[model samples]
Target: MNKTVIIKGMSCRHCAMRVEKALNKINGVEASVDLESRTAKLNLTNSISNQQIIEVIDGVGYEVVEIIDV
Candidate 1:
């Protein structure tokens, strides 16, 4: 499964990489963050909830704008 996470308060590549690392730490999740789009594209190899995804981003000090399934 794949999803897109729209995030707020990310200003540069550092911020983007931070979020990317945080999300990637989660089991069964792979993410790539794009600074320009302020988004993270997520690939799930196992069952995962949107709430879990949101919390990971939030725990890293970023606001989650939205999550869309794709």
Candidate 2:
């Protein structure tokens, strides 16, 4: 499964890395973060809900503006 999440407060490469690391640590998550676009693309090995994704974002001190399947 794939997901695209729009994130807020990502102003630099460091912020992107932090978010990427946070997401990647979750079981079943493969993640890539784009600082320019402030977005994260995640590939999951199993089912995960929107709320769970949002929680991950929030847990890392970012706000999730949206999540899309692609």
Candidate 3:
């Protein structure tokens, strides 16, 4: 499954990278963050909950605006 997550508080590539790294830490999660869009595109190799994803991103100091299947 794939999901596009709209995030806030990412201003540069480094910030995006941080979010990506944090998310990618989860088992079976592949994350690519786009600084320009303030969004993270996630590819899930296993089932995961939206709240779980939200916690990871928020834990890294960003706000999760929304998540949608893509």
The model with the greatest TM-score is 1
lDDT of each: 0.96, 0.93, 0.95
lDDT of 1 by residue, 1-70 (tens): 9999999999989999999999999999999999999999999999999999989999989999999999
| Cand. 1 TM to true fold | 0.97
Q: Candidate 3 lDDT (Cα, whole model)?
A: 0.95
Off by over 4 Å in 2: none
Which residue pairs in candidate 3 have backbone atoms (N, alpha carbon, C) closer than 3 angstroms, thus clashing?
Answer: none
- Taking the tens digit of each residue's C-alpha lDDT, what string does model 2 give over 1-70? 8999999999889999999999998899999999999999999998889898899889989999999999
lDDT of 3 by residue, 1-70 (tens): 9999999899888999999999999999999999998889999999999999999999999999999999
- The model with the greater lDDT, 1 or 3, is 1
Kindly indicate the candidate among 2 and 3 with the higher TM-score. Answer: 3
Better of 1 and 3 by TM-score: 1
Give each model's clash number. Answer: 0, 0, 0
Please give the lDDT score for candidate 1: 0.96
